[model samples]
Target: MDCLFCKIAEKEIPSDLIHEDEFVVAFKDINPQAPVHFLIVPKIHIKSLDQISKEDNALISHIFNLIPKLANELGIENGYRVVNNCGPDGGQTVDHIHFHVLGKREMLWPPG
Candidate 1:
């Protein structure tokens, strides 16, 4: 119940938020890795991708659908990358599940 992302979702902590709905919230990453970098997180914390359950299908779909819409709004027509780090070894720094939207620059292969 003491999750950082949860606080952001609850508006308990201020963030550079771009989009917010009943299911998810999108905000600019504090430590941006590219020209355009942000995070889309579910309101309900599911730890990481591995924790997602069948009941979260609709929520997961909604987040994916919103990603491109947001990218277009940002004018990233060149290309973009949606990265999700599932676990610690996968480079997941946070325990909560979130998607990183990086664009406005060409993403190379073998992103590590």
Candidate 2:
């Protein structure tokens, strides 16, 4: 288990964690893209979203349910962006599933 996010979730690595439950954890991105940028990841190593199985439904729902609250807590209530890059062609760098919460600025369309 050399996964970075897994280490963070397990408290083996230090991260500016904002929220966490039995299922998922939210923390600030090491390299933020905006004034506020964070990531929500499942504690269980599920790889990418594309790799999610039907058995992960409940956990997935719970994680999704916490997204808005996480955004609001981070002060992005006015508006924010949630991005899930699935695979290489989709710009996914890490081999784990994560939701990127970005805000604190007006986002441009068609992300260049």
Candidate 3:
């Protein structure tokens, strides 16, 4: 596929990787919104959260399980926000399903 996150997962594109396993890959966001900002993306190509199926449950669980560990390792355990923007109106720029792990600063309410 022509997905940007897919290419990063495949190592076809360079990224400042933070963590990786068989199920997912975490990397620093090129355009960080917070002092600590990174992305956790599934190795498998998933269009978006709304597209997830029952078969993807395990993958989703794995992604959640990895989030805290990554946050602690990245020293953002004190506070952080895990955001998954849905469709275009929801501000999902990329088609690939990915979680934005942002922290190191207080996240304002009603995020834009």
lDDT score of residue 82 within candidate 1 = 98
Q: For residues 31-69, what per-residue lDDT tens digits would candidate 3 score against the true structure?
A: 999999999999998999999999999999998998889
CA RMSD, predictions in order: 0.7, 1.1, 0.8
Inter-residue clash pairs, candidate 1: none
Every candidate's lDDT: 0.95, 0.89, 0.94
Rank by lDDT (best first): 1, 3, 2
Residue 37 alpha-carbon offset, candidate 2, angstroms = 0.7
Best by lDDT: 1
The candidate, 1 or 2, that scores higher on TM-score is: 1
What does the lDDT come to for candidate 3? 0.94
Residue-level lDDT tens digits of model 2 in 1-112? 8998899999999999999888888999999988999999999998898899999999888887898887777778678888999999999988889999899899999975
Error of 3 at 51 (Å): 0.6
> Where is model 2 more than 4 Å wrong at Cα?
none
Q: Please, what are the lDDT tens digits per residue for candidate 1 over residues 4-74?
A: 99999999999999999999999999999899999999999889999999999999999999999999998
- Lowest lDDT 10-mer window, candidate 2? 69-78
Residue pairs in candidate 3 whose N, alpha carbon or C atoms collide under 3 angstroms: none
